[model samples]
Target: MVAKEGYRNGKRALVLLVMTALLLAACTGKEDQGKQEPEANKPKEPVELSIWQTVLNVNEEQFMQEYGSKIKEKFPEVTLRFIPYKGKGSAIQDLIAAGQMPDIIYASVGHIFFGVLDPQLQFDMTELIKKNQFDLTRFDPALIERQKQMANGGVYGLPTSMDTLVLYYNKDIFDKFGLSYPKNGMTWDETYELAKKLNRTEGGVAYRGFGMATGAMFTVNPLSLQSVDPSGDKARFTADEGFKKLFENFSRFYNIPGNEVTQQNITLAKQRELFDKDKVTAMFVNTGAFASSTYKDTMNWDVVSLPSFGETPGVGSQPIPTYFYIANPSKKKDKAFEVISYLTSNEFQQYAAKQGRFTSLNDRSIRSVYGDDIPYFKGKNVKSMFPVKNASPTPLTKYDSVALASLGTQFDQVLIGPKDINTALRDAVEDANKKIETEKGK
Candidate 1:
């Protein structure tokens, strides 16, 4: 009996030992499994990319936020640093000079003109574009060619948004003056006649037929240049009879007696106020300006083709190709290229288009965005404002910048009668050419 009891106790002890061993083995296996994981398996922290933009104005931030935040989410590794142009030109120069440049620089098409002035400062995106099979067909070749004229073969930026100019007229003003609405193919002479009929000084108000932007001559001169070989660099317009006709045509808007319209010291905002107050009957405006005015506000107005100049359709506004540029020699070139590719895609463009009216440089995508029928774009022949046949972008070079600035000043002088049309254009062209020759060191 004693032997039996001892044997039974031994069996019980053996079973307990086996169970404990199994539990210990299981715990050891779990620890070994934990040790086998590689450090790389852990979630990587995102990359933070800084983006600089000009959407800091009070009315602009909301629209910018709609897509700006989406960009941040899409590029988890990127954090956009929205920098506003603080009304200080020196600040931009200083920030850019200090080597603290943002990963992405978003500026106007004008900047691209300046970017090409110095190759070292701008990145050449040719190879990356080829490698990624990025479709350049998405952009207007005319726009692209204009950008290429800035410098060498290196592409410095990609245009994500564009705005073309059109003529905006107040319907009420036309009705009150007993004048028909401006037609799609109306010539400058016709526009002048309409303006003359509409000008009025009554009821404690002086009404002007039209308003002009002093800087607008740079765009207007292109039509005359087109008449003298659009591809040439020389200023044939200075000597061309057609160019004189162009100036005379512009002068009609200002020649009206007792008209309050004067080009000197007038601003876009002031013009808008005039339009709102029914003081100005018509004005030329770009898509950006129009978007800023009509997004949610009620205005009794309509748009039509820019007034024609004889056989040539009136060139209202050129499509300013605002773009994003990556530094070619950037330390983070690969990533920068990726960001650019992503930004200029059709998906992103559609988002921007929905907020404001845009004609895609990519034809197919444009068709997709604006279907075969759109009410606002219907047959007052909206196509007249498109492909701006004579649209000329700013020339790239220090000389071009100086030329444009000098030209703007001179144009203002002509409009205000400080200089005759021929003398002003001649002197301006001579001064500009001299600067150009000096810059080229030829």
Candidate 2:
């Protein structure tokens, strides 16, 4: 009986030992699992990003030659695919319908304001900007503010380059008239006085003092002048005194004696021909007009700061910036931001400056290198483009394009004396509201 009891005890002890060994193995396995490498430290697979631009043709060669290589060198695992499409039509919509949504988009401020690129589809970049520690101060303050305003206080995109309206004057015309060149930082009143002196009949040829492109007058106005209020769904120009003043300011150029007929019928092409081919216009108030082929080797021209209004003295026209926005549908947002941040970096901006493209960076060093590669701008007052303060961005609404179009048509009526300033503005407000209501119903 004692031997049997001892055998039972030995069997029980062996079972206990086996159970203890199993428990130890299980705990060791759990500790090994816990010690596994973190996912963040692991290498990520390569990614290909797509970028679409309406004006890619203009910059394609430069991008391939300069930016493309830089991107490859910096991100060897990433591939950039640039696709260009027609700017004016439904190409982008077709692409979206086909499920080929781009990871990034590049366009001008007009594109966003006119609803060509849907702002709602853009990723709010405020968080990305904060996370990346990207400095907004590096760019022009006005540009940053404009982007913020368009996004309704959210930064949806960033400007890559900025262009402002400047006074482009034909030196030969100024000399022939024996009038001094328009000075930088001149007020609209002062400029008009100068224009009066330049508008005259010289040997059966009409020498107009001043002319601006259609829709260019808005650039010189205060930021408060908006055509419509999308949020309120109302016209903003009817009761605004600024709109009246703006109309009067622009019409004075046409009201000059002997200039009435030409100003009433003049088109943009005619204005360019007057400045470039005919060389009769004393001054052309436009943005970057000197860079056009019209001024190439034809007329001796110079640029001065755009005329400022009494309301915002010393402030030039608002910056029309070219912006790049990342798509909300992009799966690779972080990577897209990385590329955008790099593209807007000082290094890239300097290269852009060298390529004669105006940079958005407010760096004096970058500005110093602008137009270095282009012989056309060698002796020009390229620096005149920088010194003045940018005009506040025009408050935009959903129906900005329609409203502006209506206003522009009425403005022409005012110039031709068919309608008074107040009547034209009232009619414009009515027309714009009607259009906006129709669009909303759709």
Candidate 3:
């Protein structure tokens, strides 16, 4: 009986020892599992990208509200710092000179020459685009083509929004004048006749019939005239016959006995104030219609497709697009590319379009949602925000802005001075070519 009891004790001890060994091995495996994860599964290192745009009067907070927050929600790893242009001290040149150039820059088609390309801030995004397999076809083909042309066949940027001309007419003015409201498909000639009827005085107020943005006729002409040729680095004011037609067609608007498009009224602000605040201007044509303008609360207005040129019956104003550019000085090129690329994604584009910034995408569904969320656009004819078709783009170069300025000088010369179209065009071509040569040097 004693020998059997001792053997039982030894068997029990061996079972207890085996259970302890197994428990130790299980704990060791758990400790090994608690180590750092594999590189592929690891959290991305944080990166902050700084942005600087030519958008003045808009503060950093406004930019973050409109744009930066959208980028942050998608990329928690990225922090965005918007550098605002406060004055000459914070200007693009000032920033670049201080060696404080930002990682990203923003500007529209017309300003890109001064804001990006001329400053040598443009970084060719081609390789980053190829590496990331970004599909440029997602954007409006016209926008992509313009972007390519803007860089002389190299893409330095991607579009964020689009703008085109529209005819903005105050409902009150038309009602008071007892004229039919402006219709979308009317020719410029037809619209001119309408403006003529409204050119009159009411209660001693001198209500002008029409006013225009100084750069509008020059930039968004239905005639597809570029102030300068893209590759030749030469001005086109006198060379292209379109200039004569363009000058003649609009020159008549100013000739009305009672309604003259004044020199100061040539400014967009002057036109907007005359149309919106003064409520005296009968017809005004420009981009950033009531929905995006400051006087949204002041005016009862609606839009039509920018009056068609009789020659190009269905053509609309040239598309003016805004782009996001990554700077050559960007240390975070890969991440910066990712940031701008993601902004073009359907999700972000849809969100922005709803807020009244027109989509850069080719998606009609997205385009249809423009201004859905803006208070000013409620019940407004937002469809008129688009023309029958965006006017086919003309090739552009860095010198076009200079030429456009020259054209503005000539526009005033013809309207306010004795210069005719031929004389004005000749002087403009000479002045632009000379200035362009200076631009080339600097």
Candidate 4:
């Protein structure tokens, strides 16, 4: 009786399997006969790809004109839309709360872990890159390493552009002092010597020798120091010897007699205004002047590579990079990858380079066209923007942003307060770790 029951059950199972196969075959026949349009047509509902980046600090109209329109031209069925953040209210966080993460997200290298990784939205594009046969070698190796540093041996994003540090000098100030313009590949020590010559107060107007808008330059210091250590997952600004070595040397600028950090020029805004609008400062280690400044048209300025250090010959400051990522929750990852891949392509890069935005591509042709279309940059030595080599990218974490912010406070203490360099370094890291812990609680 048991054997008979088993045979009957096996027969029933075979019959059901045959019926299911026949039903699937009939559906396949319908699909072959173009009955799949209903399923396919759902995606035809005006393919809108949302972007959560400023795209070189552009407004909606500007972004649409430059990058958005181009994407529309290629993917005619698609509309590229932006979810702005700069100078806007908490956009990304709101999106996260609403469960509406954008298809493409842009982040500066430092913000990678905070904005993308912490949200658990980082998507490794390695397989997509391989599937698309995208060549990674075209980009500067440092930028590639930066992406890998953000992910654990995975390419989380593709570099779209960079903001490189250079020694921006007021040529008029140099002329006033009878000093020659700084040349490319000058060491920081050489820059310090030049700064000494230019540090003077003539006719009651204080002229600073060397300064920057903020302590941003030191964040990418030539010593290749990073605020946080990935190995230990804590602030490394105090522990790393490189940080002290860099800070010890850089702090000299603040002590250069007339160039001391004062109440008038101590703030970041004042430092930038002094060099840019007031034109009191002679040299500034800052981002390239690519028609970016409102004063660029009026100011007589040129740039050289960010001063290299004696300890690291020919290595420039770490590249300040911005990358494009396809968020993990994005339903249209393929289209997102296609759009971002096109963004990093030769054609788009050329267009971007001409528009005075720095290109991340290692292509000389793109680099040569750095400011071709910008009238203000016609005769400026923009080539000094690219160094012979970029310093190796260091490990980054969510704590990095907090750590860097605290450094500014501790850095101020070094220049003006009674604290020594070592003391300031210790405070910066300690304050940063405390902030990191506070943020962790949130």
Candidate 5:
């Protein structure tokens, strides 16, 4: 009877052990299945990234036709949707109010510098730049430095196109006056002397020597020159030595014997007519004006580096760069950065250069091949667009636009003989300070 009882207990213990083992195996299988399910059900679709550009001329359909295929060839799993916003105020503001923030924002350095597009609204690209080992040296040092300044020492954007000030001369006018073409790397003083030679009344019609578009006189100066001090809420243009020098240099051109007609007399609208239709203007200081189709078939023109100030010998004018900024609120930041990287890549820059678009890259090979694909640029001195260093961007204040306009009016007064340089500058300072205070009150 004792032997039978011991066998029964052993049998019951084996049955309990088998049940426990089966229960443990079931729990382990569920966990394993849970882990594999996510992988098995992962989405296999491509992500679509939206990009917004404020400029009207930039067509998305044209972009997709020209460059979209190249991007797709590289990143098949990513798609780009380009959105064009043509409006007055800040396009970013409109987008934010409408809750339509895109993955990328296209803007000018002026817009970014002046706080139109808030820097905090952009993702700091410094980390991604380091992770991807991007060669910042591939671009002009001034351009990279400008980006840093705009972001307060953080790289928040990348430049797509760089437009620098150049001296555009009418070949016909130069030839008619028996003067040689303006050479690259000439100083403002040397250029002024050349302008004197070209300023004359020919065939009973007045032909001005040298003329610049309204408001472009500021471009030739250093970026540090500002009309107002944001920190102190004061006007700096009156006391700033840079402004004094700028006024003096520009005054020399208009004060010439026959060229004293003043910009107000001719007006901005007539300035282009003078250059294009009348052909009375000999040398003009402009940026990207010669690239227009209006001049492609009509005029004989060539460009040279802008006349530099003797104080800043080798440095040319500040570049007007168009920047591409990544949205800070984007869910596809990594993908957006990839697109920006590809856009600024060597292959893309070369393609852009061929389209007659100025590339921001400092690559000599790309500069050599600039505008080669465009038939209008054939036999033109396209290589002359480069060779000079871009001037550093000036720091900006919130009141810069108003202050600059006020100061510009004062400068115009000086040019038109309504006020002397000192009085005009003093009055401009008071006017700018008042405007700044008004803006602060608002």
Candidate 6:
């Protein structure tokens, strides 16, 4: 059930239910799409594999369950039961506490710190990779890099999908203002001037230059107000002048009189209600926003790279990968790995790319999966994300949630009050360092 469109498509790649009863029967005839097996004279009993993944949206949930049916044809004897959960963290927590961990679990990039940051929670998959003779070379190099960092050669997880952040802008507004489309290398200064210039005042219906998620807070990582130096594991958010300069630019846009935003219908639903209404000039959003923007087919929009600071090369944008990990507690580790391999393999990723989800694991196959040009990407500037490549997680101790909340509190202070940028930054840096030091001692 693959639906193809001009730019976007959907692959309801489904496996027949009958094929599940005869796993190897169809494989003997079909070419090796995945791993090739030497014919064994004796047949072993099939294993039942229980899997769990968080259902954040309708499309993703459907892809998982529906794809499961298709993979069943290749391994009919192996049963895959996918249990749905809500938050990635909560799902894993509940499963762990209940002593009912699934063989495989879908994990968000944000939640990866919870597993990899803690050594005890992770299962060393190095042996499993060797025993199965799993070719680590099959995965994308970027995916392999992150996995190596987290696993420390343990190979605990497989990246399923990749998501990148870009600046989404309205086309009608650009046309009305007689402004040219945003270029890939636009700097923050240029973007700001354009935003200020394009703000139409004809009807006294003031429009904003940009709208950012005030609620989304991060003190570290590439998306944060600060970041660690990739070369050194040291917190450079405060020390790094580059980050400070970026923050200054960020604050300047928000400080604009009309740009001061709150979480109204205008704020919460950024692209749909705000940008589409021609109120906002641009927004920093993920690839998912493209889907929602075009579902109505009324909004004419384009994407560009995020703005950069003065002399530094435009850092481009940051993209996070969607991936899944198998738990060691499962009784069916072998079957679990097989299911994971299938889902993250080029075949399944190609199926997902048809749905317009951001995919980077197998770009060659995605090129074949999609048509010449996707309207969602039409006229949109596509820039590679640099932040994701250099991103490092913030300290995640037992009190990580508390530390984040504290950071949020401080951010609110700066957002609401009249505080000098230097003072605020110094205070935040000192406080965060103190906390990190305390955590390290613990």
Candidate number of the best TM-score:
3
Looking at model 5, the pairs that clash are 223-394
Worst 10 residues of 4 by lDDT: 287-296
lDDT tens string, model 2, 1-442? Answer: 9999999999999999999999999999999989988897666679998877755354556556646777777677788887666454435676787787888887778777432345356778999999999999999888888888777798888888877777888888888867787778788899888888888787999888888875866633544477677667778787668888888888888888755644635666787677777888888877763564346556788887878877777787667788888988889999989888888999888887877667898888998997788777778876665536776676666777778888888888887767899989999899989999898899
Give the Cα error of residue 133 in candidate 2, in Å: 1.4
Cα lDDT for residue 157, candidate 1: 78
What 10-residue stretch in candidate 2 is worst by lDDT? 113-122
Candidate 5 lDDT, tens digit per residue, 67-149? Answer: 57777876778777877665654366776777777888777766674323453576789998999998888888778887776
lDDT of 1 by residue, 247-337 (tens): 6777667778644445633554665567655445455433534634452234566666666566656554456667777754356667777
Clashing pairs in 4: none
lDDT for model 1, on a 0 to 1 scale? 0.59
Which residue pairs show collisions in model 3?
none
Residue 399, model 3: lDDT of 75
The candidate that achieves the highest lDDT relative to the unseen native structure: 3
Q: What's the lDDT for residue 195 in model 3?
A: 80
Model 6 scores a C-alpha lDDT of 0.56
Where model 5 places Cα greater than 4 Å from the true spot, the runs are: 1-44, 56-58, 61-73, 88-90, 113-116, 219-224, 262-266, 292-294
TM-score of candidate 4 on Cα atoms, chains taken together: 0.85
Q: For model 1, how big is the CA root-mean-square deviation? A: 7.6
lDDT of each: 0.59, 0.77, 0.82, 0.81, 0.76, 0.56
What TM-score would each prediction reach against the true structure? 0.73, 0.83, 0.87, 0.85, 0.83, 0.72
Candidate 3 ranges beyond 4 A from true positions: 1-42, 230-232, 262-269, 437-442
